[model samples]
Target chain A: MSQTDIASRLGWVAVDWGTSNLRLWAMDADDGILARAESDLGLNKINDGGFETVLRDLVAGWLPDTLSDDNSISVIVCGMAGAKQGWCEAPYATVPARPETLAAGAVKPVLKQAGLDVHILPGLCQVDDPDVMRGEETQLVGFMADHPDFAGWVCLPGTHSKWARIANGTISGFRTYMSGEVFALLSQQSILRHSMQGADDAAAFENAIRHISVKPKELLHCLFGIRAGGLVSPDGQQAGAGAAILSGYVIGSEIADIMARLGRDESIALIGAGKLASLYRQALHVHDFDAEIIDAESATLGGLRRAHAALTKS
Target chain B: MSQTDIASRLGWVAVDWGTSNLRLWAMDADDGILARAESDLGLNKINDGGFETVLRDLVAGWLPDTLSDDNSISVIVCGMAGAKQGWCEAPYATVPARPETLAAGAVKPVLKQAGLDVHILPGLCQVDDPDVMRGEETQLVGFMADHPDFAGWVCLPGTHSKWARIANGTISGFRTYMSGEVFALLSQQSILRHSMQGADDAAAFENAIRHISVKPKELLHCLFGIRAGGLVSPDGQQAGAGAAILSGYVIGSEIADIMARLGRDESIALIGAGKLASLYRQALHVHDFDAEIIDAESATLGGLRRAHAALTKS
Candidate 1:
C-alpha cells in the first residue's frame, strides 16, 4: 500500500526489538497487517540517543502528516529495547505472573515525535534461581493468547535459548542456556573450527544428540573429539560430519539439561522457525519427547497485539 | 659459565619445541645442565625449511670451533616440532606403550647444519578413542623416570588437559579435554566476558567446582548463570566472583568427568606449575582426591633427558 493509504488505515505498530535486530509491523484497527519494516539497528548497535531517530526513519513512510496526542499511533514494543540499556528501561515483572499483565508494567520514553505514543513491554524474571527474559516473554504472551489454557513447557531456541513454564495463563519460571552462542564461538574461533568446515549431516547430528543426551558429563571430551576425530578417524574428515556432530552435541546437551531439571513428562512447545527449530524438534524426538513446533514470528506479533489490547482496556 | 667453558663441557642439547615457544638446554655427558637458551620460534611460527636456521641461530655460541658429523652436537627435540605440520613428520606411537620407548619412534629431520644432529621425538596416540598429544608425552617420560614403578592416573593440565592411565610403566590409555581453551574463550570472547572482571576468588571457584561436580548436567545453565547472576543477584556482581565461578566450574567439570570415567580410587599425579596447578590441587582436594603436584619444568627436562639416554643407547 502507498504511504497515504497506510497512514489512513494504520491503527498502531508492533515491534520486537532484540539484541541484534529490530522488527516493526503496521496493523489496522482489527489487528490486520498493513505493512512491515526492519533494521539492523538492534539494541547493541544503537547509540544512547539514536533509538528514537532510527525508529522514526524506519516508520517515516507509515506515519501520518498531522500530529496530536488524540491522533497519535500506538507503538507497542517488546524485547531488549525495554532493557535497562535499551531506549527506555522497562523494569521486569517477577513471575508467577500472567503474560497479559506485562503490558501494565510497560514504560514510555519521552519523545519529541508528536503522534507516536510508544509503550515498551516489560520482561519476566525469576528471583529464586535468578533468570530473566526480555523478548521471549512477549513470545510466551503470544503463545498463551492462542492456547489460553496451555500448561506445559515452552522452548525458545536461539543465542540465549529460554525454556519457560506456563500454567493456568501464567508463566511459573524459565531458564536460559548459552548453547547457541557457545556453538558459534567454538566452531568459529576455537580449535574446533578446523574440524567444522563441512556440510551438516543429519545422521551425524542425531547420533551426537543421542550420545550427549545419555552421557552429558562427557561434553568437554566430546568437544575435543570433534577436532581429534578429523585427525584420527577417516570418516570424521567427511564433508559434513563434524559440523553436524557439533550442532547435535550442543543442542542435545541443552535438551538433556532441561530434561534433567524439569523432567521429560511435560509437553514441549518449541517456539522457533527455520533450521534451529527443526533441529530442536529432531533432537527432542530423539529423546522420545514429541514437541509441537510454534511459528516464532506469529507468536511475537500475537503477543504484541494482545499486550496492545490489554493497554487499551486499562 | 663462559661460552668457551660451556662449549667445552656441553655434551648434548635437550629441546622442548611446542606450538608457541621453544626451550633448549645444554647438558654435559653426565646430564648436568651447562647452559640454557630459548626462543619464541615454536612450530607454529616457523615457515617451511626454517626450523634448522632458527635452531642454529639460538645455539650458535654452543657450537664447537671444529664442525664434522663425528663431533656434531646431538639435538633431541620433543613436542609439536615432530608433527606432520612441524619441522619433520614423526608418526605417533600408539598406546599401550612405554613413554621411554617414545624415542624409538623418533624421526630425524635432514639439516645442513654440520654440527647439529637433530632427532624429533614422537607423541602418543589412543587409536581406540581417537585422541593425540605431542609434548606432554615427554613430561610423562621424565615423570616415569623418577617414579618408574608408579602405576596410577596422571593429570597434565594446560591448554589441552590430558588424563592418562599408567600401569606397569606404560600408558594404557588417555583422554584429552579442551577445558582451558573453553574457559579462555568463554571469559574473553563470549558474553560472559563482561561479568568476569574481578580478581580470582578461591572460595567462589571452589563452590562452582563443587556445584558442577555434582550436577554436571547443568554445565551450560551454570555458565549462563555467571552472566545472569551479575544481573539479578547482587552478590553475582561482586568482584572476582564471576571469574572464580568460571574457573572453578570448568576445572571442577574436568575433574568430575575424569572421576566418573576412571572412578576416584586411583591416585592422581597432577603435573603442572603456577596458578593452574594450584587451582587444580585445590579442586582435587575438594573432591577428597589428594593429587601430588609435580613441577612441570622438571618433568619436561627429565623426560627429555630420559629420551636422550634411550636414543644414545640405541
Candidate 2:
C-alpha cells in the first residue's frame, strides 16, 4: 500500500519531536488538516520511559475505530528519536544522503508496553565534527521536496541552532550552534541571566542587535560582567535578572558573529519558534538581508511525512 | 617530627605531581635553594600502579639514607592526587577554606614501594557553585601566602584559567575561564583555524587587542570574520593565518571585555606555563594593566608546603 492509500485510509499522522519541545499533527484520510496538538511532552520532558505514556495520552483521542494486530499504525518520527535514548535510537546518516537515501533509520528495540510500530528518522551527522541533526534533517528533506533547486546555507535557529550547507541537492556539510544552550545557560544558570532585567522591553532586544553588530567582540566580555557589574556598579543596573542581559549578549553576539561569517547573504532560510525566529529576522533585516521565515510546523510535518513515505515503501 | 626538623635533616626533597606534570624539589633545611628535578611522569602517566616507581626514577639520587621502616620520610603532594583517578583520592575542601583548609588531607594508604608517607592536599570547592579546583587552587593559595596583603581579582590564565575575588587575606570567591580550551578549539578545530597562515606573532596579538578595546562591542563579529576574511574579502589583508587571526581575535577580545568590568585598582595575577603566562602578561599589559607572574613550580610547591603544615599541625 502506498502513502496515498495509507493517508486516505487512515489518519495522517505527523510528529515533530525536538530536544525540548514535541509537536504532533493529525490529518484526515485525504491528508487534509483535521486538528493540531502540541504538548510539553518533549523527549527532555520525562526522561525516556514517559515518552510512551505521554505520547499515548496526547494521541489517544485521535485513535481510529478498529485496529488490527497485523495492520500496525503507520507513523514516522523525527528529532532526538535517533539520539542515544530516544524512542528507537537511529544511527546517524552520513552526508550526501540522497532523497531515496532516507531509510527507517537504525532501530533499537526500546522497552515498550504498547506495540506502536514507529520508525524514527535518522538525523544527518557530520562525522568530521560534533554536529548532529534529527528533526531538522526531516525539515531539510521537506525543503528538498519543495524546492529541489534551492541550495546554499539553510539555517534552523533554536536553542541548538543548525546551519546546513546544501549543494547539488546534497547536504555537503552542516554545523550546530550552541546558541540555544548558551542562551539558556546565560539566561538561567550563569550570572548573565540576572543582568537581563528588562526582558519585556523589545527595544532592548533590538538595540542589543545593533550594539552586538557594532561590538561583537564584547560577547565573552559581557559574560564575565553579569556578576562583576553587580558588585562594582552600585546603581543596581546590573543587579536585576541576568537572562535579560545574557539573552541580549548571546543572541546579539550570535547575530553579529554568524552574519559576519555568512556575509551579506540573502540566501539564509530562517526556521524556529516565535521570539527566536523574530529576533533572527530582525537581525537579518538590520543588515538589509532578506530571510524567509518558514512555517516551523509545516517544515517538521513535511519533513516527517517525506520520511514516513520513504519508510512505508521499504 | 616537625616539618622544620625533618626538612633540616633531610636536605632537598619536594614533590609536585599533577594531571600531566611532575617535579621534585630538593632544598636545604632553611628552605634555601637546591637542585630541581622534573619529569613527564605525572599522575596521569601512571594509569594504575606505577606512580611510585616513576617518582623514584625521577629523583634517582634524592632518596633517603636508608629506607628504614621506623625512620619514615615526609612528602607533600598537591594536585589531582585527590581526584577520583589520581594517585590517591584526597577529596575536596569546601568554601571558607583557608590556607590550612586542605592541610589535613588524608594520606595515601597504599605504600610507595620504598615506603614513604605521601600526603595529598584536598582540592577546593565553591560554596555557591559546583566548580571545583585542584592544583590551581593550591597555586592560588600559594600566591595569597606570598602576597599576604594582596587583595582583589587574581586572574590566572591557562587551559582552565581561574579568576578569584580575593579580599584582605582570604579567597572570597573564584570562577574558571575556558579561555584556553576555547582558544585551542578556535585555533585548531574551527574553520578559522585553517585560514590563519602562520604561528602567533606579538604584533598580530597586539593588533587584535587594539581592535577589541577600540569597539569592545564587535568582539564576536571580529571572531566570526577571521575565517571569512580569507575567503570573501578582496584584499584579504588578513594574510598568513586564520588561526592566528582567530587567536588574536579571541585573546584580544577576551582581555578587552574582561578588563572593562574590572576597576583600575583591581590586581590581576597570572600563573601558567611560561609562554602562556608571557603572552597573557603582554596582552593585559598593553591594555594598560599590570599583572604579577609567578613560577608555576614554586607556587605548586608552596601550596603543598602550606597544606602539609596545616594537615600535620591539625
Candidate 3:
C-alpha cells in the first residue's frame, strides 16, 4: 500500500481524552483506524501522579507496531487532554493556522522510554473571545478534505455545545452552550430527572418541542410549573419527567433563538454522535432547515490526523 | 384611632411561617398589631412531631385572654407552614379564590394541646395550570386593602419574584421567576460564588442594571462572559456583583415579556420593602414604564388581620 497505509496498519495512537473517559484509537498511516483501547482513566482519574502510568498501560501494546524507520509515530490528540488537569494542557494555536499551517506542538509523553515521537495537535480558538472553541478544528480539516468548498455553519452539539460560523475554509466565530451537560444534569441528575421518565415517549417530547418552540416567552414560568405540575398532578410519577420537559423546553427555546439569529438561508450541519445530532436536526427542521448529523468520533479522528499531516509538512 | 386601624388591630392573629423563620402579629380590638413575636422555630426544625409545640411557644404570650370564651381566639396562617412539612398541607384553593375565600376553606386544624385554637389558610393556586402562593396570598390581600380602587399588575420581588395581574379586585393571573433565588444561590452557595466576591459593590450592580436595561439583547451571550468580566477584570470583588447584573438581565428580560403582553397602559405597582422594590422599579422603567414601589410589610400584616376578621364574621 501507500506510506499512509503503512502508517494506518501500524497507525500512531490517538486519544480523545474527556472529563470522564479516555478513548484511544490506533490508525494506519493511510488514516484508517485499526485497533482501539479505551479506559475510564480520564483526566478526572489521573489523581495526582497517575496520568502517565494510566495512559501508559492503556496503550502499552499499540505503540510499538505503529513506529517506522523515521523513529517517530504520528500521535494526534484532542479534548480535555489540553486542560490543566489533562495529560498536558498543550497551548492553543490562534486562527489562520490551517491544516498546512497547524503546529506540531509539545506533548509530555511517557519519559525514560524510547522509539516513539508524539505530535499533539493544538486546539483552534478565537482571539477576541479566546475561551470559545471549534472542536471541529480538526473536523473542519476533515470536512475540508471531504468537501474542499465547504463553508457555513458547522454546529457541534455535546456537553458544552459549540456553534461555529465557518467561512472561506476558516472558522471565524463560535459560541458554546452548556446544552448537553445541562440536559444530563436536568434529565438524570437534577431534581427534575425522575419526573421526566419514559422521555423515550417520542410523542410527549414532540408535543413538548411544539409547545416551547411556539411560545418561548412561557419557558421560565413553565419551568417552575414543572414542580407544581407534579404537586397537583394525577400522575405523581410524571413530576420528574415533567420537570425534564422543562429542560427540553429551555433547550428548544435556545435553539429557536439561534435559528432565528442565523436566518433562513445559511446552511446548518449538526455535527456530533447520532442521537444528539438527530435531536438538533429535528429541532432545526421545525425552522425549515434540513440538517444532517455527522459522527463526532470519526470527524475528530480524521481531523486530528489531517492536522498532524499538515503541520509536519509545513 | 381610625376605621382602618380598628379593622387592623382587633381582627385576629396573623402568621407567616416558612422554612427558616416564624413571624406572628397579634391584632387588638382595633385591628392594630398589639404585639408581634418572631422566632427561630421555623417549620424546617419541626421535623415530624414538634410543629405544634414550637408554634405554641412562639405565640403563648400573645394569645388573647378572652380567646376561647366562645369559639376561642381565631388565627389566619399562610406560607410553607401550611405545606406538607408544616402542621398540615392545607389544600390549595385553585385560581379565582381571593384571600377571603381561601381563608374560609382552610384545613381543619388539629388541637395537640389543651385550650389551643388555630386555623391554617390554604395556599392559593392555578387550576388550569400548576402554581401556588402562600405568603403572596396575604400580600395580594394587603394590596387590595391599601388600594381599594387599584387595578392592573403588582410586582413582588423577593426570593421568588412574582408578577400578578389584578383586575376588578380579583387576581386574574400571575407568573413567578426564580430570579431572586437564582441570584442568592449562585452568588452565595455555588461554584460561581467562589469565583465571585460581590462583597459590598452596590455601584457595580447599579451600573450593571443600567447596562442591562439599556441593551437587553446582550443577555444571551453575556452569560458565558460573566467569568471573563471579573476574572480577566481589574476588579476581583466586582466579579461577584456580576451576578447582580445577570440577575438584572434575567429580571429585565422577564419584564420585557410582561410589558409586551400587557402594553404600556397597565399600571405596574411594586409591593415590597423599599430597597427590593426600587431594584424592580428601575428594571421596569428601563423597559419604558413607571412603577410605584409600596411598603408591603404593613399591608400584609393588615391583610392577614383582615382575613381573620372576615372569618370571625362569617
Candidate 4:
C-alpha cells in the first residue's frame, strides 16, 4: 500500500519512546500493524517543547491529509517519553496495581498538530523499597495479556535490567540491576578493556558464572583477576577468554543475587530478544534455572493494544 | 638554595611513577629530602622509548650539570613505569616474600643519560589467585620499614584499592578492589550522576554502609535504589545524599567482602592520604575495625629508601 492508503487505513499509533530511541507502529482498526517507523531521537536528544514536533514529523506519513476531529488518530506512547523530562510528564502509578488498569493513569499531551491525539502511559513505582519502571510495565501488561494467570518472576535484561514479581494479574514489586551498564563500562572503559580484546568463549563464560556463583562476594576481586590473568600468563589463555569472563562475571552476579533472594526453584520468564536474551538464558541455566525467552517487541505492541482498547472503552 | 646548589647536594632520586602521574624525590646521602618534582607525564602518556626524556626533563634541575661516573646518581623507580609497556619491564616479585627483598627482582634499564643509573623495582604478584600490584609493594616495604614486626592487614585505598595480609614479615596474599574506579564511573558517568549532587553527609554515608552490610547480596539492587530514591522522593532527600549513599554502598560492599573472608578481630593499618583515606577509615570504623592512618608519601619514600639502601649494598 502507498503512504495514503496506509494512512487511510490507520486507526491509531503506538510508540515506545525510551531514553535512547523512539519506535512507532501504525495500527489498523483490527489492531493489525499497518506500518512501522523508528528514530534515534529518544528522550535524551529532544529539547523542551520539541517532542510534539518530532513526533508529528515522524508520523506525518501515517496521518490522513484532511484535518478534522473525526479523523484525529489516537497515539499511545510508553517509556521515558512519559518521564518528568519527557514530552509531557505522566506521573507514576504506584503498585500493587493491575497493568491493564494503567490506562486510567495515562495523561494526554496537548498537541499543535490537528490530526494527532496522543496519550502517554504512566510508569509503575514502589515506595517502600524505592524502585521504579517505565517501559517494562507495558511489557508486563503484554505478557499478562497472553498468560493472564502467570505468576513468578519476569526478567527483562538491558542496560538497566529489571526483574519483576507478578502474581494475581498485578506486579507486586521489581528490582533493577545496573549489570548491563556496568559490563559495558568495564569492558569498554575500565582497565579490563586491555584484557577483553578477544572473541567470545562459551566455556570461559560458563566457568566464570560458576566461579562467581560459588563466591559472589569476590566480584571486585574477580574483575581485577581478568586483567591479572592476562598479565601472569600472557600467552597461556585462549583468545577472547577475558571478554567472555567479564560478561559472565557481571550477568552471573545479577542472577546470583536474584537466586539468593528468591531461590532457583521456579523458572523465569525472560522477556527480551536477541543476544541479551540469549545470554541471560544461558546465565540462568548456569544457576540451574530454566528460562523461557519471550519476544520484547511483540509484548510492547500487545501492551499498547490493551491500553488502547481500555482508552476507547472509557 | 639555587638549582645548582640543590643538584650538588642531591645524593640520589626516588621515584613513584604510576599510570596517570609521576612523583620524584631528590635525596642526600642521609636519605633526607633535597628537593622534589612531579609531572603529568605518566606511563599512559609516554610512548615506547620516551620514558627517559620525560623523566630527565622533570628531574633536570635536580641533577648536576657536569656528568661523571664518580658523581653518578642512582634512580630507584617503582610502579607501572616498570610494567611490560613501561620504561623497562621489572618482573613481579611473587608474594609469601618480604617486601624488603623486592630489590632482588628490580630490573635496570639501559639509559642514554650517562650520569643516571636507573633501577626499576619489581611489583608483587600471586600466581594461583592471579593478582598483581606495582607501586603498592614499595608502599608495603615502607610500612614494614616503620613497623618491622607489625603483623596485620594494610589497606591502600585508591582507584584500585589493595588489602594485604602481613605476617612473618611477608605479604602472604592481597586482594585488589576496583571500588574507587567504580564509584567514579557511576557518580560521574552513569544515570546516578544526576542525583549525586550536594554536600557530603556523614550520617547518610554511615547509614548506607549499615544498610549494605545487612543485605550484601542486594548490592546491585542498592545501586539502582540511589536513582529510585531520588525519583520517588525528589524533594525529601538532603542535598548530596545520593552521592553519599553511592560512596557508602560501593565502599561498604568492598569492606563487607573483606570482613566475610577475614573476620574483623584485628586492627588495620590504612596507608593513604586525603579524602579517600578518611572515607575508607570511616567505612572501616562502621564495621567495628580500628584503622591507623599512615601517610602514603612517607610510606612510598621510606620504601624507596629501603630499596635504594639494598641496591647500594648489592
> For candidate 1, lDDT tens digit of each residue in A111-143?
976889899999988777678889999999999
- Candidate 2: deviation at residue A14, Å? 28
What candidate 4 gets wrong by more than 4 Å, as runs, is A65-67, A263-265, B2-8, B58-60, B63-67, B263-265
TM-score of each candidate's B chain against the true B chain = 0.96, 0.84, 0.83, 0.96
i-RMS values of the candidates, in order?
1.0, 9.8, 3.9, 0.9
Give me the candidate number with maximum TM-score.
1
User: What ranking of all candidate models by TM-score puts the best one first?
Assistant: 1, 4, 3, 2
Query: How should the candidates be ordered by DockQ, best one leading?
Result: 1, 4, 3, 2
Residue A71's C-alpha lDDT in candidate 1? Answer: 78
Q: After superposition, how far is residue B153 of candidate 3 from its true place, in Å?
A: 2.1
What TM-score does each of the candidates earn? 0.97, 0.54, 0.83, 0.95
Q: What's the lDDT of the predicted structure labeled candidate 1? A: 0.87
Q: Provide the global lDDT of candidate 3 against the true structure.
A: 0.64
Q: Write the per-residue lDDT of candidate 3 for residues A1-314, one digit (tens) a residue.
A: 44344343674677777667878887777767777778887676777666657766776666555444467665667766665555666666665555654445535555445545555555665545423442456666666566556566777876666677766666666665545544554455434444564444444445566776666556546656665666676475444367336546655765765665584456777767666677777667656778766677777777777766665565
CAPRI accuracy category, model 2: incorrect
State the DockQ, from 0 to 1, for candidate 4.
0.71
Q: Over 4 Å off in model 2, which ranges?
A: A1-314, B1-9, B112-115, B199-204, B210-221, B260-264, B311-314
